[model samples]
Target chain A: MTWSLPLRKFLLYAFIIIFGFVMLYPIIWLLASSLKPESLIFSEPGLWPSEFTLENYVKGWNAVGDVTFGLFFKNSFVISIIAVLGNLLTCSMAAFAFSRLDFPLKKVFFSCMLLTIMLPTHVTLVPQYAIFHNLGWINTILPLTVPKLLATDAFFIFLMVQFFRGIPKELDESAIIDGCGPFQIYSRIILPLAEPALLTTAIFTFIWTWDDFFSQLLYLNTVENFTVPLGLRLFLDSQGESLWGAVFAMSVLSLLPIMILFFLFQRQIVEGIATTGVKG
Target chain B: MRHIRKNTITAYLFLLPWLIGFFGLVLGPMVSSLYLSFTEYDLLTAPEWVGLQNFIEMFQDSNFWQSVRVTLGFVLIGVPGQLFFALFIALLLNKGLKGIGLYRTVYYIPSLLGGSVAIALLWKNIFGFEGIVNDFLAILGIEGRSWVSHPDYALYTLIILAVWQFGASMVIFLAGLKQIPGELYDASAVDGAGKFSQFKSITIPMLTPVILFNLVIELIKALQVFTPAYIVSEGTGGPSGSTLFYTLLLYQKGFSYFEMGYASAMAWILVLVLATLTALIFFSSKYWVHYENGGS
Candidate 1:
């Protein structure tokens, strides 16, 4: 308040604009390089194509040996959609149970669930891979989808539990008095009312599963089974002749879905992630 | 009591899927991994009891120590770097600014895609000899090396990547900043408190809990970092193993080399390390973290 209002406003805007541009440079650079010819990609350092070309897109789309890029996109979508549905259905149910119903060992189970949040995923990686391998689920999408279907992501379960707990207990009480079962109350009341939380879970599940590379890489090997991340990894060649333009082209394409989701549901995603951090 | 029995059954029914997952996907594997740590097992062969040999071997293994050093270095350096940027940006954005939404979105984009293979590849290229970074350095007449391939600089690039993706922490910090009562600032201003004093007394103490949350989360994440390191190093953890994250090393031991027992020991070590660190933070919170509602 001591300084001139215009001066403060000008300084803030200038700093934000400069910082925003810096943060956005990599993405913008990727987009620009995607449009550039392969020869000019590294030659031109600035984030603008001197000579635009669609050669990279065409080549990148067909670059993989046998499988087309469409297959990878379809595979990624299939896995992510299953994961989203799995989290929405299974996590919400678990959350409803934890929030509403009285159960034996509920406290113990809940604490165990919370403890799993701190357990690193890699700790279980070896044995789980062994289990799946024994189950003959290796090299399939089963490894990715099955755990999700079983609500292994305790983070989303915790998020939904918080949301369900916020709903007035009066609704559940009245429903029970009307002879409604727990399932009915969950299906008819809690599920419909927790739309924002469910949306947050759905969006996050889709994006994280789609972007997940490590697990996908571990379970999936064949080109026919590769997800988008694995597919993009194929374009990279550190020892051989690398296709920089094509890689950038596919990279931009890979980020499109996530970028669109972030733009459309920015507030929900931000709120969901922030609240989880604070509440936890 | 009869109603309680029925309700318990119904709740268990609702929790059936998660219970199955907890037992199958999580608990079973965790127990098995612990057992595997003390046994010699390759995926093809049955596990042979080896007692504490795996744990003993880990301490003597230079590569294991290297990974420990690398992971510790990452957590110590990267966590602070990320929190600093996040808090600084959060403070800047807390100002009632125009186009705040646009700026927030732009800043958040990196965190969104930071773990993706494409971003990792982009980072690798950006620090390469002929990449954009070196091209920029060329303008200043300074020769630039391939930063990603240099043992000394490879880890720093990863740290820079970590700091670049500070949007999630920033957003959380922004939320925390917003929760601070505006009345506090107004009251402080009336009391003739300078801005620095106001921030130190009013802002920092209030945000201590949020800071703790961010620190613990960042520490856990920093310790387990794998994807970017894997991608940038091309799964070799090359450039003299400087980019070899603990998880990547464990992955190699379990999957690549098929030393399941060794990897299991490493995993348990990671768990123990994380547990101790988290407990330490929790134990120390009494001294620094302030709870306004006084429940602490």
Candidate 2:
């Protein structure tokens, strides 16, 4: 209280700005280094590149063995889009039922859904692999996209259930009195009203699926089927020191979709985490 | 009666996908995994029931024990370290500063990128021998080694990476901080409480529920951490196996070594351990965690 208020504010801002720079320096360094020529990446620790080149981006796009990074991007987009659609359709449907409808054993089913949110994926990994393997779903996108269609992502279901619970029951009652069916209420009223939650579900599903590595590594064997994460991993394994620029370039490219999504839907993503306690 | 029947049928129709998924993907796989744990199956041959052989061998496996130690060290150290930074930064940002939203976004970018292969790759190079970390240390005249490749420091780098991504938890903490009523702080000040004392008396107790939430979530996440270790160690868990996380070891066993049965056993152990730890935390919550509605 003795110090001038402006002085205190300046000091606080100074500390926060410096700390913020330090936190972001790694990513900034990455962007800068990716622009630099390969020879100078590690040698030049400075964030600014003396000279910039698009060579890394060009070379990295070609990636490994006749498989362009474009293919990986396409593969990633296909899987992510399918996953987003699957989660939105199935999770919202499940949430609508749980939040509005009456059914036998609803409590038991709801409890099971909640428990699955906390259940570790490891317990289901091997057997899930076996199931997919038996169905000849290996080396395909089915393994990634199929389970989503069944609402196996219980986190999104839980998230949507929370959102759906906030919708007034009177809306459903009026629809019912007007002779609208549950399906009509779901598609017409709830789905339209749940846009924010649906968008949150879509964004998170896309980002998670795009970033997912383990299942993709397991099922996606061929280079043609490799998603962005797998393609990036291939860069690590196949490339040498000279390709560090390319690696950094591809890495930045790999994160672009997520970065864009985060920027566009920043409020929803933050609120999604706050309300549901789900990780971004 | 007809309306009730129609509603029940409609609910089941809506739940049809989840039910099929539950029985087909989750419950079925879980039961199959449990059964597989007691057998010796390599995916090529039929599963031959061995009755605890995999579990018995796991106890004597030194690498398994090493992985347990590494994973436990990671969860124990990394979770608290992350939560501490999160809370601290949250408090700093909770001061109603200008451009707080920008600061929050900047801090949160790491958490968004944290789980990706690109970030893990970036972490590996950043800690490499000639990486930027050493370059910065050189400015201070402190010689540094390849932290990721070094046996003694490999796991620490991963822990540091985990801690670096505290932005998500920090955002959660910030939300919790905003929820604390201004009246409480004013009342405590009227009683002549100092800043630190007021924080102790008011802030800590009010934030316990959010703290517990972040703790459990981060604990489970830290236990399952794989991408960073896998990428950093190049899937070898090398440099004398200092970074052999449990999930990494399980991945190697099941896929790389074709020891599906043994891996199934390991998976069960993780499930049991995770369940017990979560239960312990929830049970301990009654003693410390304060709810406004007097405990859920």
Candidate 3:
């Protein structure tokens, strides 16, 4: 038997709404919990708080010793921004060379770059840590940010290479006829045209750097240098009683930048994944 | 000849940063890490050659095997579960309803924040003794314990968390679903095939390539799961190491205990296992994975 279109539509929308609520309940609960007082947080499990308080936000800001939450936010921004710029410049340059220019040992280096994408980060973590320690880069943002500047993330290079390959080579030929060198072509034509890919790279790099906790935990010792993730961890570890309210409040604040970015660039973020899925 | 040489020089100049990074950062450390795996080194002292003792010790080490079991269990269980949820949601979204964008966004929010410390903390709280899960259980007249604190259930909670971040895979599947020609569906419908038959015969077979891709990605990611386990278990991998993922144990060894050599050995083992599994997936794809442009 054929069902009425509106009836089927209603069912589908109902299912979507219910599943969407289920998907979002924890985050909604988190936001609600952050607003509740410590005494009421556990007692009231609903998404709507019986009584709301901003004391947790006030306390969590200054919970860590002498290093307020603002410092952690600043540290995260500094690292993320540097990482975004680093990936855009360095990865694009590498991609440009591979996609546009011909050179000696080009095939060897291209294969090597592809191989590194499959190599997990943990396999190199120990020795890399030692190298950074020896170079006095440990405990500083240098170990984290400097690597990005060196185009160490093969994933971005690969991504840009795919995008760059899509751009017609005739554009390069025309630019060359105008006496434009490789650098000039890259700066003027490819860079401007690769805006979407660059934004995708920048957004992902920022979000990943901000979310990375393990490396930050390993390298940064002092609270003053801690990124948002590490600082949020400090909120849990420093207190014996475990300040759930403060923890929840700080956690909510930690996610603010990502949430804002997600909302602002929703299409780009989704498109990036879709493109990578199909092309990759 | 001079022009060719000049072009090579320019290309290398463009690749200067990557060349430096590959040689100085990646290659050097990787070689040294392999060497370190065969030595005994703490952060305080130089690595002294111990000749495969770390590997030998790994087999006998109870905790090592526990982590292996934990990681394998996670990968085996979590990957399929996550993929199923992804494909299911993708199928739902493929129906093409009104306001689908909002649903997609809501579903995707968790994945965007999946690896964050904040989400990990939220997970811990959500499953804690006085948390929402228990409160819901109580409403159903069933008593509940803190799922994360119990050894029997900690890993399952982690698996649930993994499945919750199914949005990325779902989007990939959605793309794949969209790629299937609409004419095929209409033709099948006209031929008296039901929705289920169409999905099974047409959708599933056509979607195998995307399924393979999602499986490999999900497997690798599930194996390397760290932040959630770290935060939920307070970095101890405890409640009797039930949540001690392989990467977490490696981190504790290398960073916390300063057993760099041992951790290096563990890391190498992980790399080999992942490589083999990826290779297996690639090899097995020849049997089942479909390509629209090619013969079976």
How many backbone clashes can be found in candidate 3?
A: 0
TM-score of each: 0.97, 0.98, 0.97
Candidate order by decreasing DockQ: 2, 1, 3
Q: How accurate is candidate 3 locally (lDDT)?
A: 0.89
DockQ of each model vs. true complex: 0.69, 0.84, 0.69
Clashing pairs in 2: none
In terms of docking quality, how is candidate 2 classified?
high
Worst 10-residue lDDT window for candidate 3 chain A reads A271-280
Please, what is the whole-model Cα lDDT of each candidate in the order they appear? 0.90, 0.92, 0.89
Clashing pairs in 3: none
Q: Write the number of the candidate with greater DockQ, choosing between 1 and 2.
A: 2
lDDT of 1 by residue, A90-174 (tens): 9998999999988779999999999998899988988999999999999999999999999999998898998999999999899
Worst 10 residues of 1 chain A by lDDT: A271-280
Relative to the unseen true structure, what is the C-alpha lDDT of residue A2 in candidate 2, on a scale of 0 to 100?
75
- Per-residue lDDT for A28-123 in model 2, tens only? 999999999888887776788999998999988985878799999999999999999999999999999999888999999999999899888889
Summarize candidate 2's per-residue lDDT along B66-87 as a digit string, tens digits.
9999999999999999999999
- Report the candidate with higher TM-score, 1 versus 2: 2
